[model samples]
Target chain A: MTRMIGAGRRAIAALLLLSLAACGAQPRSVPPPAFNSTDVMFLQMSLEYIRQGEQVLTTAQTRAKNAELKTLTAALQAQWAEEQGTMQRWLLGWSQPLTADPSSGAHEGHGDLHSLRPSDIAELQATKDNFDGTAEALLLGHLHNCVEVSRMESTGGQYPPAKALAEQMAATRQGQVQRLLKLQTGSTMGA
Target chain B: MRRRIALALLSIAAVVASMFVAIAPASAHGYISSPPSRQANCASGKVANCGDIVWEPQSVEAAKGSKLCNGGGSRFAVLNDASKGWPAASVGRTVTFNWVFTARHATATWEYFIGNTLLASFNDGGAQPGATKSHTVSMGSFTGRQTVLARWNVADTANAFYSCVDVTIS
Candidate 1:
């Protein structure tokens, strides 16, 4: 009887260990979202231009007489058209679209920064100072997004095509940063 | 007789061991229905008119000034953080939201705000800066559609973060 009891204890211990081992074999936690940093950079750049255009458009709206804003609007319209084309090409070639659908809603585009229509700019930047502040915010968001995207890409395996695109995006964003910085500093200094 | 005596001893040992098994009373954690109210669902970017916010919470803080048991608004705002919608409150109930943080005093604090209200206020707590904290007052009365606001104040100094979720009262 004593021998039987000892065997039963061993059997229970083995079963418990087996259960624990099985539990350990379960999969780990889920991975983060699939979006990479390259997408973030592109999204940020697109948003910057949108916001810049919106700022100019808003200035046009608040002023009793600002004809230059109209010209600015026209220029932005062309720029956005070009940008959309670029994004579409990338989307076509890259298996998926990086840009959000503008018609989806105000929150559709990257992080709730919606497309600024010609009409929206006038109302959005009615006050030059307010427009400037908003512009600054949008630019900051753009820069932050770029840095974030690059960080993600570094972690993602380096693919030549994706890396090249990231480089180009970084260059373009850098240029934008220069231009926006000048605009903001110029305005701040009252130059 | 010897075997009977051993069996009684074993039973007593088992009873004593069971008594030492520390059974603690279960704590009551508040629960909102698995899927929260949709009338003020802010995920879609479309504001729902009043008469939509409804949720069943198994347990909620009944403290006054709590923001957990409240919902209504012309524009309901739901923030999807990590893809989960922090459901809006409807038919206001008293709830107190508490956040605790520790920090040094007179230091530049970094903070984030969602709507117009100050959700977090940080103070340089001193050498051993204690926790910074804030809370929102959940309404006691539910009358009609009210504009729900999600506001945040990050750090020691910053503009309030603003977001809106509108819900209508029925």
Candidate 2:
């Protein structure tokens, strides 16, 4: 009985030691990149896209002839404003100064809204009869562009939180694009 | 008992290590480079007044089958504006499309078009692509000034990167 108890004690000691070693000797994986310029660019571009979308959607809410179009624009305006806030928080968390850094040249030449062109907007404003159709077409194009950028960020971005956000944004925008297509075709397809 | 514990801990550690190894690389997106797509030119400063595209040239993305120069996005709408007078590259009957990838991913296919006409296509079949890939294409009797649209479709994703290159064939 005495010998058996000693053996049991030794086994427990050995197990404890192994657990400690396991905790201590765990290999440290390579740290993620300190700052990825591309990620910075992506975040900046995403914010810009959101800003431009909000602007366009706000205008469409009033100018859109279709009731559905007005509702969609209002919903999108709220969503984009919330997303912009989230992106700004992420920028803060990443320790990136809100102001554009001239030395890094990260934010230079970065202000163009990619989805709706000036011509498209002008056409939408000019054509009062087919306002909803023009708005739908332009919004569909914008949503497609947003989806593409989000997809790239989810796959290529270094920041985990940003990547997750990008994934969610991609799904949401893709669904919106599909819904807009259905609306354009005059089909009440559920998203 | 000691051997069993050791084996279990070792198995756990091995699993952890494998998890770390499975993580993808940090950067993994790209665009067309051969004739210099509109975004590429903007990035390299060859094109002026390109707007946000000059900041991130790899992001000229949109839904597949869209003909918009800036990938159907207003932020990149400048690419669609012909008034910018984008310079055209002179090429021979045969030209290579070079794709520079910062981070490679499983690819679906690469298609090149000239004004709605399919010029050449390469099927990648969901295999992971390399950092840089070059595909030689025969211009196929089409000549003169043209805009070539190159589309890179990802196998696992619902999006594609589009590049519009202005080219003049001799």
Candidate 3:
């Protein structure tokens, strides 16, 4: 029995020593992280879309005939501006160029996900007196684009946080789309 | 004879339990790994004079909402020093930030900021993340050398993890 007790004591000491050494050892480095081209392109293009959509917001807020549309536009401005800032940081952190390389044929499989060009912005401004009509149409298209790019990111993004945000982005933009469609219906009836 | 055997067995069990207690880690949390935060740099031996943070990179945590790298706590306050000249990773306009956890904790949101402007935030919806997490952030129009403060806000607790990464965007 004495011998058995001695052996058990030795085993415990050895186990304790091993655990201590394991904790103290220089940590072996793990590979950084996994992020694919899709992750990169999605973020880049999303920023462009967000910036372009922002231009119409001030116009909508001041000029929309529909009260809900004007208030919703203001709310969207605050929310999307924050998102734009978030995407910008993600792009820089990944070490990719801030400006997206959409025209380079690199974003091949991703569907048409660009924001409204200057022409669209120009047209939006041209509808100055009746901004609600053009605002509804232009923003509806932008929100659809938001959902598209967000969908692409959700499906192809390997970065879990980015994917999680993409999912939330899709859901929010879809909700916004429904709201805009309702406002458009009401505006058309009033007109 | 039986009582002697019982006492010996009890002594052995007591010794083993004490060993296990000694081995158990205290407050194993997490810190940023990529673009290597200040604490991470200290742990990796990339920077010197890091104090206790060199051993416990994951414990640079304190209550939420402090702009300081150490969350305004005294234990890891060396991270708040601006003169350390920590090596800044040369990155483009966009970069992906990654993190490694010593022990996963329920997370609320991961936020990044430059100066007073919030660069980004990734919401976790009160979920326990894996051992690692990655966030792709755009620097936007921000250029030149900048120190970005990254934070991990815990879901259930009032505390959050803090890290600062210096970067020169070329």
Judging by lDDT against the true structure, name the best candidate.
3
- TM-scores, in order shown? 0.30, 0.42, 0.44
Alpha carbon deviation, residue B166, candidate 1 (Å): 42
CA error at residue A82 for candidate 2, angstroms: 39
TM-score of 1: 0.30
Candidate 1 chain B lowest-lDDT run of ten: B25-34
Tell me the TM-score that candidate 2 gets on chain A alone: 0.68
lDDT of 2 by residue, B7-34 (tens): 5754454343323222312222566654
| Candidate 2, residue B92: how far the Cα is off, in Å | 0.7
DockQ measured for candidate 3: 0.01
lDDT of 3 by residue, A1-191 (tens): 99999999999999999977775563447543556666666676677677778888977776777788888898889888888888888767655665544354323322221335565667667764546755875676566556666777787778787888899888777667656545643443244
Stretches of candidate 2 off by over 4 Å are A1-191, B1-28
Evaluating just chain A, the predictions reach TM-scores of 0.42, 0.68, 0.77
Best by DockQ: 2
